[model samples]
Structures are given as structure tokens and as C-alpha cells.
Target: MIEQKVIINLTDENSNNLGTLTVSSIDCKNCNESRVRISNSLELINIPVVDSADNLTPIQYCPDIGANFANLMFLEETEYQILFESSDACASYDVLYSLTKLNENYFKQFRFSLGDNKTYKIAGTLNFRSYVGKSFLDIRKNKINSIKIPIEVRSKKMDYFNQYSSMIADLSHHALSLIFEVNSPLYQEFELDSKEKKTYYEDFMFLEYLFRNENLPSIFEYLSKNIHSQLKNRTEQVPLSLASNFNQNSLKNIVSKPNNLYKYDADFEIVHKLKGHIPQMIEQTKHDDTIDIPENRFVKYFFESIRDLIEKLLLSSDEGYIKDKLLFFSNEIEYYLSSNFFKQISPMDYVPFNSQILQKKEGYREIFKYFLMMEFSFRLSWDEINNQFKGFEKKLSELYEYWCYFRLLKVLNDLSITKVDFDDVFKVKKDNWSVSIKKGENSVKKFKFILYDNEIEVELFYNLRFSKNSKYESYSLAFKPDYTLLVKIGEHINYIHFDAKYRSELEIADYYNVFGKSDKKLNEEIDKRDSLEEKESIFKDGDIYKMHTYKDSILKTEGAYVLYPGNKTEQFFESDMIIPSVGAFSLTPGNDGVDENNLENFIREVLKTLLFKHGLINLNWKSLDK
Candidate 1:
């Protein structure tokens, strides 16, 4: 082991005169443990560790020290380091030198052997304070063999710059107010008025047009259309046998003698009338290929006359208006072949043959239409109307749309408006195709359909087993549908499909044929693409049919209806089915054309069918009448 005998001989060379150090150690310490015993004491003196082959042991760095540490001492083994440190110490004397404590209780009593004659020379200018937990100490000679053992210090405080920067920011705030030179990189993220921002699909009409002409980009494109067609087709195919009831025209006339036909409520009028006069028109059993319903006299006649027209209105036209409105929504333009659509489907005419006051009120139509005409006149930039008429136009628009649902109610009234004679309006017999299951009453895993908010979420981490082709990307985002269905008629579970669409349009090209030539993404949207069969086949197959079926069912279903803030109802081709104006539902039930009671009944039936326990009974659900 290398022994260090350090002696501090003070001669008072400079100021800040502190203390001295002396060493008396040749003690036979253990060879293995990292320790050294020393016998000498000094104030304002430091003994530090340095790096060198012969100077220190243990090559790893240790950082645990502070500046201004007192009673400083370094135990040198030259092999192992067992540095035991205590500070704020009292002192004792060596054989000749008097010692005073410096830091902790870290002083020495072991003698220097020279009992009375000791001379140490240390300069007063060097104020040597100690530190700990450092890798190495630097020794620099200062003139006469006196050296400075540099101590590596741990920082005492952080936040030296923050205190100064705050003052500058305060001054800037007072001087510039809101008109400061915004020079920060974060300034590019300026806030925008979210209400004024354009919608993601502001040009949704263009997408609608493109979708009608071009084939879709996925396997589920036609599913919705096919589903709608199937449903409508099945509805049209229903047998039209009249119910068992007496004719009500004469009864209506008899009741009208008091000018109170509008409020007429005859639950048993037909039965009362037929007791003696029309006995043959009482009971007649009818049979179709699949059904058996009794024919009522009055109900039969009432429906028989308009059954064809109602069915034509219901089943014939592909497009339809909400009761009386001019708003239209359809898959194909051919379905839009009715009246002038939104422009002509005035909302003032359908005042219920009952609100005779509103019906008899003739100029009401002009008043109602004048404001809408003027507003639209100004909006579409047709004939320039004076801005002074703005207030009148707004008021008329309000009364016409509020007090009278001209376009809406009329379209609903105009719906293949058939009156089915029920045994009881509230109680229809259970001839349902299948049992209705409420949520949790049935198994979620066994559902025929599933809808999720994130199609990508399901495909990733969830590990859904579906392959991607040229037509649709594996991680493509699907529609955020309002509802999901799980129908299981027959063993058609193999018809598993989904409908995923974007509100935005993507002009997808034939990746199959054109991809072979260049293998790049095509930019433009083509109207007709007979040019790409194999690529388009993905979207044209039975899979797509299944998906579209589910999609269309959800789209047209009562709960999953589409809505907008500015939509309007219109008569496109037929009756009330086309009445999905901006914020209301349409009434177009299956088999029997929709009527007053049918709306409620259809809702209850759909709620049951949808398996949702929460039905739409209490909801002040706005109807096409709105």
C-alpha cells in the first residue's frame, strides 16, 4: 500500500487564511478491504481522490459530493476505498501539531511522533473546501510546490435562467398587449372559428353523383341497394285482399251533415250501418297463394278503389317524397321522376282534410309560398328580390314550415296512402317471420351483423380475420353507422357482410387492368368502367350484395335514419317513404302502405325487430309532418 504523510506548514502567505494538514500513517492496514486509517487533522484543508494507475482503485465513477464540505478527509488504500466521512467535527492534537475541527465530527488524535517541533507551511489565500463522489481530482502546482487539489462539485441549484426570463416576459406583455410580434414556432397553430369551418363533405352532392354512375371501391358497395330492392320487392309482392268492413262513404256523408266531419270518430259506424241494409257484404273469406284473411265490406271497398294507386305509389316509384315535401333522396336519378321535387313539393297544402280551417284558408298557400319563394329567390340568385322583404320572407318561411307542413305532410298524405282495416288498430296479430330478441336477451356473438366505430381498430390489435385485395384496403375506415343489425333468416349466416363507406368521395380506378400497365394509383374517377371487370368484380360479387343489404337496412331503418341541419322533404316519385327531410323520419311501412296508426305500429314493430329494449314510444320523434 502507498502511504501518504501530509504536513501543513503555515507561513501566512496570503488572506482567507484557513487551516493546515499533517499525516502520520504507515499503519499496517488490511490488504483486502477498501480502507485507510489516518492520524492528522486540519481546518479549511481538503484531501481528494485522483485518477492514475498508482493513485486510485476501482475504475467505476462515483458522483456524490458537495462543495464547501468541511473536516474533509480522503482515505487512500491505493487498492480499495473505504472512505468513512463525518462532518462538523471537533479536533485534537498530533504529536507536535494542534488540531481544530472543521466540518462534522471528523478529527484526528493519532500523533505525528515529533512531539514539540512541528512546522507546516501553507498559504492563506487558498480556501480549500471539500467535495465528495467524484471520479478524479486535479492537482495543479501554484508557484512554490504548493498545489491546488481541484474538487468536482455537484450543482446546488437549478433554474438559474427562469428567474430572469419571467421579468422580460412581463415587460413585453405590458408593452405590446395583444399585438405582440408572435415569433414562436407554436404560433402557426392559430385557433379557427369551428362553427364557420366547412364541412368534411360540403361537396357531398358531387360524391352522390359520382357514386350513382361509377362502381364502388369495395366488396360491400351494392349491398345496401340490393337490400332495399329486396325489401321493397317483397312488400310489393304482398297480396291485396280487402278487409271485412262496410263502405264508409255514405256514413262519412251522413256524419258531415253537421259540418263536423273533420272531428268525426266512428269506431263502429260501418257495423252499425250494415245491420239491415247490406247483409251480403258482411262475411266473405278470401284466400291468396300464402295467406288467409277475412274480407270486410267497407274496408274492402275503401282499399279496393285506391289499392292499385296506393300500391303503385308505394311499389311503383323508386323515389318518394316525405308526405308533402319537395325534399328527395334516392340511389338512382330514375327514382327522382316525380313533380318538380324539392322546388314543387310545397309544404303548405297538406293541412289534413280535417283542419278544414287551414284547408279552407286559401291565400295561406300564397302567404306561405311567398316568403320561401322570396328567400330562395334571393339565395339561388334568381329574380333579385329586395332585402327589405327579408323579414317577411323569414316569417313566412317560419309559419309555412312551422304551422303548416305543406311539403312534409302532403308527401306523407300522398304516400301510397292505403287504409288497412285492422281488427284492432293497437293489436295486430303476430304473423312475424321470426321472434324478436332484445339486446342481452340474445347472444352478441351470434348476431348476424356487427358495427364498430373504428374499422381499423377491429382489423388491428383485435386480429379480425379478413383479407384485403386491390379493391379495398385492409385498414380502410368504414362507415360510422347509427346502428348494426344481426338478422338470421334461414341458414344465411354464411352471407356475412358489412357496409363501410366514407362521406367523402374517392375516384377509384380499375386497379386490375390499369394496375397491370403502370402499378400506380389512378387519380381520376371514371363514370363507367367496363374497362375493369376483375378489379370491379370484388365490389360486384355476392359479398358486396350482402354488405349493401346490411348497409341499406341500417340507412333506411327507423333508428338508423340519416339527418342534416338543412335537409328538406320532397315528393320524388311516390309517397311518404321519400320524406327524410333535414330533421325528421319518414313513414313508409312494408306490405301495407303507411297510414296514421301504421306509423306507431311500424315503430313498435321495428323496435322489437331491432332487438333494442328501448323503443321510440315516448320520444317526441319528429315525423315527416314536421
Candidate 2:
């Protein structure tokens, strides 16, 4: 005797069941057998039989009765499988399944049909290498019942949710502010023409931020209440008999003839026959109070444009929270546009700088301010902005690289570093205010300070490249570190390079394990490498040896280090020498925020060594050349 039941199992990389799977039986009026649907066209056949309790046994026993949401914990870049089985043999069945990322634009679908088989298996690799968030798997049976399983994807490399997300958000926010601080030259070139302005990612981000702002609702309400109006005069034709007032120009239309006038008593006939002609119509001027001023027209145009933008974002966004917010803003804009106040205003072309009401009125003033900001947002085309940082949002490595740039800036600023020259740090290009830093360019920031009566000139470079064809040529091959700092005291100059590694210490440890060694042992071995080929191989693999490559290949390099988001900081030094060294520094974002003390202390130590301990340079520094 076979028991009527069905079972589905979800397993991890090792083919171990994550949890128990259960299914409930639905009654079929025409059939006595119980059936369960698994996935696309896949159904379980159950044969009913009566037997003694002692002799009866189930094919697969499940403690749970009905299907329930299962929690599946997934590691990024791992493989997993789903297995389906029934108590009895089934002729044919189809199954439909899909994995969808919650609130993100990612999904994968799978379909399978089995014939004359009681079991079926589906296998796939789940690669959330660059993302960590909530997702779900949906399995449908017979196209009637759906079983949804929730999945939590996590990164084995770093603290992706709290640390990575927070750091990226902070970096993106700062980058956005920098972009806003600059007025694009394109705006001046285009002459503020709407047709010429193109929307970019920054513009969308700004609009999203603007719509979510708490002050926006109050601004709209205030503008709606205190709308400005102007008196408009319009000319219309009216009958001559109905004209209340007549001027000399209007009176000329009536001919002066004796027969033209007819005098009669209250009910008597006319005394004289008709005249030659009489004017049938006259032009009259009418005055009306209209909210058709430039300010009002601009307000209408702004709302309409914003509403359209909201709709566009809505179509592109899949996140529930973001969609909800967009919908709310869209509805609010729609309501305002359809309101009596806005309906009274007529649509007109956006006339730049023609609104006194916007300039003087309190509510309109705020709208005008944002309108100007919006104009700046529109100046940069999407292609240009995208080219600046390709895949910035999707790739965590790219995001981490940019974040390190800004984070280092904050650290330097916190140390009271004063600018000696501002030309390369920040500048106005054409009409746009922008940071001077660009990938593959010599973006430098120079600072000077007096230490022990010696003037130290510090130059920090971002994404500085060294090549055979460049001024600072590499001895072996071209290599570009994320940041390079040069310190000049008198005639001697020292260079230190830093590379931002997105991999955490744990990942490095795992990589070393593949070679049957621990990270500490590998580091020791790396320091002992004598052959150039070994060093070149490690550098090609992009391990800690890359730091070695920087220190060895770049001329005058004192120290080369790795800046990673990890908990441990490892520093190594050459025998009897501190200046020539290689190490990794922990510079990760924490719950409270990034703790720069580790990196900051190391930098101060390096500066101390450079300034005070460099061959009596500090002792006679007062007499050294500037």
C-alpha cells in the first residue's frame, strides 16, 4: 500500500537538504486519487490503499502537512538544486519555476517536464556576486498553486548590507553634491533651452531627492494659495445697437442723413423713410483677471515636467519602496495640476528670468530656486554622465574605488592639511565648477605645512598612472595605483603609493588556502620571493604582490600598501629600514561609521619619519632650500 503524499527538497552546494518540504492534498471530484502539482505541468500521482497500521509505510515522510514559506539562505556565487518526488509513479508532469530579485530588475526562469518518472531534479548556479539583498523563488504546479520561498543572498567577502551599502550611499551622496556644485558649461552653451537640455542619471537622482523632500509639499501648497495674477485686455465684436459707449471712430460708421432717423410715438409708425447705411458691428475691449503670468506659467510647466519624470522613474524602478514613493509624488503632482488654482493658469513656453513674482514672493522664490537647480541638472547629457563612471551603481568594486577616493580626502582634511595650491584640486572649467580629478589624468592636490621649522610640500594624486611612455615611468610594466602621495623637503622627494582593494581579509585568506597555506605564511613567502617570475605571477593574479610591484617598479617609491575593508592591519618592513615597506591597512566602514584612526596613525608616522628622521634634514631644515 502506498501513501498519498508529495515532497520537494531544496539543497545547498553539498546536496544537503536545507529544510523539510511539505505539500497539502486538494480534493478532485472526478478522481479518487489524491494529486499534488510540483512545477510547470509537473504533478504527483497518489494511489489510495487500505492497510493495517502495522503493515502500512509511506514512501517519503514529511513532518509538516501543508506547503509553507521556506527560508533559504544563499551565499553569493554558489550552486544549489531543487528536487521533486512523489509517493507513486506519474506518467507526465510539467513544472514552472523562477527566481526573482525583490525590488530589483533581476530574474531567471526555468521549465521542465518529466515523463514516466517519479522524481525530477533542477540545478543551477546562483551568482549574486555584486549584489546582496532579498529575493524569492516561485514554483508553480498545474498552473494553479504557487509556492513562494524567500531567499536571503549574502556576500562571503564583506559586510555588504550595513557596511558596503552605507559607504556607497555616503560616497554617492557626496559625489552628487560635487556634481551639483558645478554649473555645467553645457548650460551656458545651450542658452537654457529646454529642447537642448538632456536628462542624466544625476538629474533623475536629484529629482527623486527633490520629490521626497519634506519641504516640497509645503512649497507647492504655499504657491497654490498665493498665486499671482495679471489683468489682460481682449477685443471682441458686438452689435451696434447693444454698444453702451461709442467713440468718434465708432460714430463715423453711421451716415448723417435725414431719412436715417425715424421719429415715432410710443406705438406709432416711423415718420421718415430709411437712410443709406448703418454700421452693424463695433469692436469692444474686455478686461479680465487671469493667472497667466510668467511665474504661474513656469509653475505649471515645472509640475507637468516633474509628473512626467515621475512616470518615467516608475516604469524603470522595480523596488517596492521606491515605486511607492514615486507613485505618491506622481499622484500629488497630478492633483495639483488638476486643481482649480493650476487650471486657471495657461501653459506657455518657459521664459527664462522673466518672473518678478518668482523673484519677490516667498513661495515662488523657493520654486524658482529649485527650477534653477533643475536647469543645471538637465545641462549634462546622459551619455556624458554615464561615460564618467560606467556601471557605477551595479558594480560594487567600482563603487568602492570611488568611495575610497572621497574617504581618503576626508581623512586628509581631518588631519588639518592646508592647501598650498588650489589650481589642480578644484577649478572652473569653462562655466562649470568641477573637481579636477579624472581617471588616467594627473589629478593632484598640493599642500604645505611647517614641521620643526622645515616646510614640507605634500602632493596627493588620484588615479595616477605610471607607464613606460609617461614622465614617471615604471621599471617593469605600466601600473596605476589608486592614490599616490609625494613629499618634497628641500631637494629630496619620497613617493608612497596606495591601492584600494575591494576584497576583504577573509577572502584573501581563502585564496591563500587554495595553495595549502595561511595568509600569514603566504605574506612571509611573498616577502621572501627572489625570482622575478614569481613576483610577476603574483602581480598578474592581483594579490598582495601587486603592492610589491608598485614599490619595486615605481621610482623613488618609499612604501606601497593595500587599503581594504577588513578588520586586521598587517604591516611589514625591510630589515633596518622603515621607509621601504609593504602592508595592508584596514579601512572599512563600521556601524558607527568609518574609523580612520588606523590609517590616519600610519600616515602620521610616515610623515614623522619623512620629516624628522631623514638624514639630519629636520636638524638643518631651517637653512634648506624651499
Top candidate on TM-score is: 2
State the lDDT at 19 in candidate 2: 30
Can you give the lDDT of residue 187 in candidate 2?
35
Every candidate's CA RMSD: 40.1, 14.9
> Model 1 scores what on Cα lDDT?
0.23
* Number of clashing pairs per prediction, in order: 59, 10
Query: Per-residue lDDT of 166-243 in model 2, one digit per residue for the tens?
Result: 664464345344433334333344344454433345555555446533446778777777777878987666775788
Off by over 4 Å in 1: 1-483, 488-507, 510-626
Evaluate all candidate structures by whole-model CA lDDT and list the values in order. 0.23, 0.54
TM-score of each: 0.14, 0.53
lDDT of 1 by residue, 1-626 (tens): 43333343322234222233333233322223233233322222122332211112212112232221212233221111111111212323121111121222123222232222233222111111111111212111222222232222111111112311222222222211111124322123333222321221111211222222222212113222221111111111111124343245434433444332223234555434533222211222333341111111211222222223233333422221111111212322223222122222223322232333223333322222222222211111101111112210111111111111212222223232232111111121123211111112121222111211111000100012222342212233333332232233222211112222111111222323443544333322232332232222112222222333333432232222221111121112112332211112222111122332433343333323332222312332333122
Consecutive 10-residue window with the lowest summed lDDT within model 1: 454-463
Model 1 lDDT at residue 42: 23
Model 2, runs deviating above 4 Å: 1-120, 133-165, 178-187, 196-200, 207-308, 318-369, 379-393, 410-437, 441-455, 465-478, 504-549, 566-605, 615-626
